[model samples]
Target chain A: MEVKNTKAYEVVIDSIKDMVFKRELKKGDKLPTERELAENLKVSRTSVREAIRALEIIGLVESKQGAGNYIKDDFATSLFEPLSVMFMLQESSPKDIFQLREVLELECCRLAAKNIKDYEMDRLLAIISEMKETDSEERSSILDKEFHNLITTTSRNKLIINVLNVVSKLIEISIKEYRSQIIDLFKNDRKLVEIHESIYLALRSRDEEKIIKAMEKHYTLIKQSVKM
Target chain B: MEVKNTKAYEVVIDSIKDMVFKRELKKGDKLPTERELAENLKVSRTSVREAIRALEIIGLVESKQGAGNYIKDDFATSLFEPLSVMFMLQESSPKDIFQLREVLELECCRLAAKNIKDYEMDRLLAIISEMKETDSEERSSILDKEFHNLITTTSRNKLIINVLNVVSKLIEISIKEYRSQIIDLFKNDRKLVEIHESIYLALRSRDEEKIIKAMEKHYTLIKQSVKM
Candidate 1:
């Protein structure tokens, strides 16, 4: 019973993946028509379509209205659906996801320390200054997210940014849950402001070790306070 | 142009994410009706529907034919799309992807070292034995992949297993490319067989450090042979 649910579509997907792996199907390679795939695999076109939709959701393939499905060279945009689903289903413990976030964000901070340009630094400072004036937790959270987003952007690697974006979204849900919890725990808005300021200073100083240390400290505090 | 692309859909997505983050939209909570959301956001129902579809694709919400969408409790499956896309797009250099695979596989080996039971160990050994006798490169590769898949399954974490599955698929592509570039790279089937045996022995012995070291060595050799 379990095999029927999982195996049929998997077989079709694996066949296509194998073609991609073998370079028989390169990026932008239009798949054989749906009928052809069904004939080749000895499976119903329904199963083939299911596999194709799954692939499409995952960003491996894209379908146009008139044009048939084509392989995507860039899979980032397509990743949102599957990633969103995985985050929802895993009952993923908050602690584990947060730990993963810390690792990724610390790496981001280190990269930003080394690579952030003067204009970016100026912009970051401006954001930090704006963050200092914001008292609303909702606004603060958005600013906090934007700060991290900016750090990732400055890293200038689409892969890292994409990863950060996904992980951040996953944790952002929990962060929102813990918003009041954080406010109650910290009580001192100044402390939160200081943490962001310190992180900004470390970035501006271009001290890789210091930046990693500060970012780690910031997340460690949040982890402790949230008890995730 | 870039800013324009980041439009209402993203805003709606983020707003829904905020609700999830806040625990306002708990698992199994029925989301706001599309009409209600459209009214609240001052957007067309069509736009709201588009956002909902995007969310559904990402595993954030599930929609039934008669019923409205409901929040998913966990997100393991939804993650496949984005992670796969990132793996394909960011992995510009095959070597970078291979390095990531080595890191992940080593982690898998370490996890398997302590956890693999006798039946699992036997299954792994049988896979290696099959690889030793398999004359077809295609068959050998499938066995090789299954061997790794077995280890991931034994890890007992869906998130880790899913990520490894994506990595393995990417590695399959890399391996095929490598084979094309260097004809007969797998001709010395005996050496490949020995490497798997060594890894299996490490797993059997339940030696975490040794398993990691062996997996790393094996991957390093693979990287050298692939050279790209």
Candidate 2:
């Protein structure tokens, strides 16, 4: 029964995809209104609505009130926000999320080592130092996010940044109730500070081999502290 | 005006997200009906419907025709179908998509090296042998995809497989008209077979360093032939 419900909605969406494949619909093109789409596709208005809604969520369509839904021109939005919630529900374990994060962050650090500017390096180093000085859990959390965001941004790949940002949010949700990965990098302050310092130093050196080592070390410490 | 349209729609969606954050919603939990959401949130029923539609597409919500919508229990659906459409339109060049595919495929090869079974090795070796003999362009293309898919499945990571599958589809769409990356892995055939052979051997041996070198070789060939 539930599967039927899934199919009815998917049928409508597939019809729409067919239109895309045939070049009948295009990016930034306004979709037909609900009634028209339902009538044309011979589906219920409700199904058409659901299909378009699903398309919008997948970052392919954008809804404009009083106007209508149009195909999105770019996918720069927080695509993984809903994706994160989906993970939070399905993946009871954080292993997949953690592994995906590690892969992207390593790539980010490797790229950052090559592309990071002097000022960006200074900012990251300062974030590490601030991590050392901060005693508040809230402060540690903020500094930790700032530290990674700076590095991810420095990597200069919008696609990686987009996906990584969502994965990081998933990580944040997992540990928000427990302790964040940063809070446990040492289970104490000094070790946490040093672990991050190593990352900062690796980026400063701009050595690919050293960057890989430093990134792996960072994940190892976090994985050790993490339940997963 | 465009900005206003974007915000009005976002407001309703943000309300739904807040519900998730506040613990008012749980996995597989049913959502309030459209009227209830419209009234409580003081938005139009149209807006509420659109919000839920967006959520459903993100794999965070499931809708039942008669029962109502529920927070989705899992996210194994093709979340990237629309995402691929989004990219096919926005990205005029395939550089970003190509780079992303390279990164994920490299990871897949690394994991496959460690996890692939003897039977899997035999199957992959056979596929490569077929690739060498196939003179039909269509057959070569299909075999090429099969070879990659087998390695990816052997990696045994659902999340990687999920994301990679979508990324692969995006690549297929990109070259569907011009020529696939595989078709161009070598403008001529022998180089293509040799390149993939290195990858297969590296995997069968399960040597991490060899796998990395082979994977890099594979991408370097494609990139040189690729306009990007």
The candidates' DockQ values read 0.12, 0.33
Error of 2 at A20 (Å): 7.3
Tell me, by lDDT, which candidate is best: 2
DockQ class, candidate 2: acceptable
Model 1 Cα shift for residue A82 (angstroms)? 2.2
- Winner by TM-score: 2
lDDT score at residue A35, model 1, on the 0-100 scale: 85
Task: Name the runs in model 1 displaced over 4 angstroms.
Answer: A1-12, A24-29, A35-50, A73-78, B1-86, B89-91, B95-165, B171-228
Structural similarity of chain A in candidate 2, as TM-score: 0.75
What does candidate 1's lDDT look like per residue over B1-228, in tens digits? Answer: 122555555456656766765567777789899888877776677667767765565456788778998876555533354355445545445645654455556656766776678899999989998887887888877887788888877766454555555455566777676644333665566766788889899888888777867787677667667664
Each candidate's B-chain TM-score, in sequence, is 0.81, 0.74
Interface RMSD for every prediction, one decimal?
A: 5.3, 3.8
Residue lDDT tens for model 2, B1-228: 122555455666777777776668777789888888777767788888777777776557788889999887655547556554544454434666666677777888887887889999999999999999988888877777788889888877766676675556666765454345545655566777788899998888889999989989877777677645
TM-score of each: 0.60, 0.78
